[model samples]
Structures are given as C-alpha cells and as structure tokens.
Target: MKILVVGGGTAGTIVANNLARRLTAETRSGKVQLTMLSASDRHMYQPGLLYVAFGQMTPDQLYRDQASLLEPTIDFHVDPVKKFMLDKKQVMTEAGKIHNYDILVIATGSRIVPDETPGLTEGAEFFYTEESAVKLYKRLREFQGGRVAVAIGVPHKCPVAPVELMFSLHDYFKARGIRDKVNLKYYYPIGRIHTIEAVAKWAKPEFDSLGIEYETLFNIKEVDAKNKIVKSEEGIDVEYDLLIVVPQHRGMEVIERDNLGEGGWIPTDRHSLAMKGHDNVYVVGDTTNLPVSKTGSAAHFQAEVLAENIASIIKIGAPVRDYDGKIYCFIEAGRDRATYSMFDYETPPDLKPPSKPMHWFKLSYNQMYWTSVRGLL
Candidate 1:
C-alpha cells in the first residue's frame, strides 16, 4: 500500500508519525510505504504565535526542521503539491513529479487574508504570522496611551484568540502601568461576544471586571486609515489610535483552484474524516469544513483517529475508530493565570476558573507541543 500525506502542519505531522509507528513491520518488509510532502523544510508551532505577539516567545523558538520531527521509516519531501487529480488518484508536485497513492491525506492549512477586508492590512496590526506577531509586539511596546480597538473577523482559526488577546492586552498594559490611560474596546461581528455560548457566558464578567468595552453586531466593512476610523456594516463607525484585527481566513489556493471545496475547505465526513464523495481521500485540520473550532487540539484528535483507522485498514482489512469532534483549548486569562475548555460534538465546553497551575501547564505544553506532534503525548 502507498500512503501519501500532504502538508506538514500539526495534523499532517501527527498522522504521518503515528502511521509510521503503527505500520513499522509492514514498512520494513516493503509491504507498505508512507510519504509526506510539505511546502517548507520547517514545521512551525502555530499556537506560539500568540505568545510571540506578547513578547513571551521568539519566532525562532517556534520552528523545527520538518524532517527532524518525522520518523525515519517515512519518506519526506519539501516539494508542495500543485494539482490534486482526485479522480486519477495522483498529485503533481511543484518540482514536476507525479506521485500515486492508494490513500491520500490532505492537511493543507488555512491562511489569513487581511487584504480581503479593504484597508485592513494597512490600518491594523495582526499576529497570525511570525512577522505580524513581531510587528504587533513592537507597536504595543511603543504605544503610550490611546484607544486600542480590537476587531474580529469571521470563520478564522482559533475562536478563543480574540478573547485571549483582550486579556493579554489588559495584563500587558497593567504591567506597563498604563492600563488606566489606555482605553480598550472590542468589536465582534456576532450578536454575542463569542460564537460559543459557553465561552461568551464565561468571558462577559471577566471583560466587565477588566473595564473592557465591547460592541456586538459590528461586522467589519472597511477601514478609513487616513481618518483613523473603522466603519462597520451595521452603520457604526469606531475611531481608534491602534487597531488590532483577527482578520479572515481561507484554505490554501491549490484547494480552491482544484474546485475541491468552496474557499479551499474540503467537505469532510465528520465521523470517518474522509473527504466527501471520495472514499480514498481524507481531510483534516484547517482544511476540513467541519463546524468545529480550528485549533491544533482538533487537528491532534483527528490525526489520531485517522492514523488508527488507516493502519487498521492495512493490517486487518477493516477500519476502527471515529473522530468525535473533540477539542481541548487552554485559555490564557492574564496575570499569570489560565483555564481550559474541553468539549466534543455531543457536549459543550465547561469552563473553569483561571489558576496559576493551569497557567504553568499551558506554558509547559508550549515546549511539549513537539512531543505531541511526534505522537508521543
């Protein structure tokens, strides 16, 4: 059997590593082959970007050589796939090589599209990437005192980020002794502060205690950079000194060009994690159009399920396991305290009070992320 995994993000890395460990005997006997193709030679710990924005971590600390993280039994390449001929069961890489596979895993992740919102890229600071995180940190450091407006865009990865950013900003300003001088305002597109009802309920009191002002039903339309104003589709205009935006996200261009899915998100089976209508093809991570929070936790859970099912199919001629939409996310509640949310498709997240131990655990996980990706956690 020939197995090809594309994209070397959290989901892809875990799936490949787990499969290599499970099918070690088959691979050694030349009965099965495992391969991975990625766009770059380095794999990034994406969650660390949030810490980067707060000056808690450096960009260099978030990366490891992609090959170093993969098992030696798996063949890995730095060439990115350009075309997905699903019907033919082949993918053509940028280096002009076509690889055939009995099974294919597509984990091409999402990307931030600030330019999609008019004037946003020029007017606001965002931290979805390393450069943007560094830039936001510098701007926060240089800021004296003014209205710091945080605007959120829809369908973005990490639903809890805006909330965490709010708390982090409050703590940062307080540490700088300018919390009283800086006015913090948050603008959310939905009717509530967050899409998840449980999260919204949990954060409202926290926001009030921190004196964070918020405006709901305020969808971002465009930014008037010259006038220092942001106009919303709901006929409200907000003026700001510094604008931090979450920005919109879309899947990779290759997925869009191939018409595999609208906005590059492949329609996936929620239970089996297979691409809709294609039995041999699977989807995971930010590339799936599942109604779940797009976080590394979700990717990890889905990867484990896929690795198990695929290995079972090869060994026993059948599959086992199903992805239950499970996700666990750590919420940084500022002031060296933190909490977590654990949920699945059948259950809503129950939040706990922030504590120092949870905060330390979150910090430890930042270093342990590499181990998790290696299928050790």
Candidate 2:
C-alpha cells in the first residue's frame, strides 16, 4: 500500500519515521511505499524561534535541510501541494503532478494569519517566521528602551511563548541597565492568562513580581502603525515604541481548499486522531482541532498515539491506540528560571506545582535542543 504524508514539519517527520519503522518490520516481504511532500528544503525548528528572537539561538541552529531529516525509505517531494482531490484520493502539486495514495496523512500544520487583524501586519513585528525573528532580534538589540507591548491573537501555538518573550525582554533590559526606562505590557483575548488554570495561577505571581502589566479579555482590534498605537475592542488604547504581536493562526491552504477542516482546522477524533469523515486519513500536530495547547510536546505525544493506531489498522484492520490529550509546556521566565506544566484531558497534571527545579529541567531541555536538530529525539 502507498502512503502519502504531506508537510515535513515536526508532526510529519515523526509520523513518517514511526510508520516506516513499523511497516518495515510488519510487512517483512512486501514494500510499503511512503512519500513526504514539502514546499521548501528548509526544515525550521519552530520552537527555537522564540530563543532566536531573544538572541539565545543563532539562525543556523533554528533550521536544517528537510532532505537530511527524512529517512531514505521515504520519497521526499520538495514542492508545494496546490490542491487535494478527496474523492479521487490524490494530491496535485504546484508543478501539475499528481500523487495517488491508499492512505493520506495531512500534517500541513498551521500558519500565522497576520492579515486577520486590521493593521497588525503593517504595524507590529512578528517572530513567527525565521526572517521576522532575525529582524526582531536586531530591533531588540538596537532598542533604546520605550513602551513595549506583547500581545497574543487567539488560538496560537505554544500559548506561553509570548509570555516567555516578555520575560526575556524584561531580563534583557534589566541587564542593559535600562529596565527602568522600558514598560512591558502583555495582553491576551481570553478571560484568563492561560487556558490551563494551574498555569495561569503560577503566571500571575510571576507577572506581579516582574511588574509586567497584563490585561485579560482584551482583544486587539487594530494597530495604528504610523502613530505607534494599538486599539483594543474594550476601548483601550496602548501606545508602544516597539510591538510584538502573535497573529491569528489557521490551517494551511492545502487543508482548507480540500474541505478537510472545519473553520480552517481539521476535526479529528480526540482519541484516534482520525479525520472525522475520512477513515483513511489522519491528522496530528498543529493541524488537528484537539482541545490542547498546540506545542511541539503535544505533537510528539499525538504522533506516538496516532502511529500506534495506524499500525494497528494496517496489521489487524482495527484501531487500538487512543490519545489522552496530553501536553507539557516549559515557560521560560528568563535568568535561567522557568515553570513547567503537564496536563491531560481532564485537568493539568499535578506535577507538584511550579518550582525552581522545573527551571533546571527546562534548562537541561534547552541544552538538548541539538537532539531535535540531529533527529535523535
């Protein structure tokens, strides 16, 4: 049977690897053809982008060639997916080539929709892309200290990243002896700081200690770039010399055009991660509309469960694995201290609450970032 995995991001890579390893051993004699499609050769380490903005990681460390990350058993297509014909079970590339597959995995992931917000794309700088991260790094270095605002648009990956950025910025200015001249403000659309209540509780005290002003349920309506002003739906006007905005996110165009998603995100079974209507299709990582934080750790856990179910289906024509909506996040609070949160479907796991030991754990993980680069993780 032929399997086509689209998109070569974190989810795609892990799923492809797991499937190849499983099918090779199970099939024994017959070949299980696997192919991966991607738009570019650059495989970005998205999680590292946050560190890149803080000048902690270099550009070279944040990206690698996609070809190097894949196994030789899987065919790699370095072209964009222009369209997907669901009825025909084929994917057509921008180059006018079509690929037929017995089973398809849509791991195209989500993209930042900066245009969704009025004037956001024009006014504020974003750290989502490699180029933008580099630019933001430069801007941060040359900054002379002024009102800095960090805001989050709804439904973003790594929910705590913006808060981490704020902490890092605060530490940066404090070390430069200009902390007193800078004002940092964090705004979120939700009624609470974090979707996970345990995390929000931990974050409140941190914000209080850092003296960072936070506004919840404050939706940013528009950005007045020329005037360096941000207007919220609550009639709050925030003036800033520098703005860091996390734009709105949506499923990739490939998924949207094929009607594979609901409101731009693929709807999947919370347990099996199989597409709601299509049995032969599965989605993992940031592509799925799961009730969990869209972080790399969440994707990793989903990949493990999804791979097991796919293997079961291939071997016995039945699903065996189930996802528990697991997610773990490390919130960097600068100066080598961070808070960690572990959660599942019911509630955030009780990891004895956030403490300094969690900070060390985060540090150790950061040092092992090379493991992901080497594809060892």
Top-scoring candidate (lDDT): 1
Model 1 alpha-carbon drift over 4 Å, by segment: none
Which candidate tops TM-score?
1
**How does residue 117 of candidate 2 score in lDDT?**
88
Q: What residue pairs are clashing in model 2?
A: none
Assess the local accuracy of residue 199 in candidate 1 as a C-alpha lDDT between 0 and 100: 86
Q: What is the C-alpha lDDT of each candidate?
A: 0.94, 0.81
Separately for all candidates shown, the number of backbone clashes (residues 3 or more apart, or on different chains) is: 0, 0
lDDT of 2 by residue, 1-377 (tens): 78888878877888877777777764345557788898888787787788788788887886778887776677888887899887899989999999998888888888998898888988898899888889899998999988989888877888878777877888988988898888888888888876667667777788889888888887889999999999898888999999899888898987777787864689988888888988888888899988778888888788777766787788888878789888887888786777777788877555344467777877677656445433356
User: TM-score of each candidate?
Assistant: 0.99, 0.94
Model 2 scores what on Cα lDDT?
A: 0.81
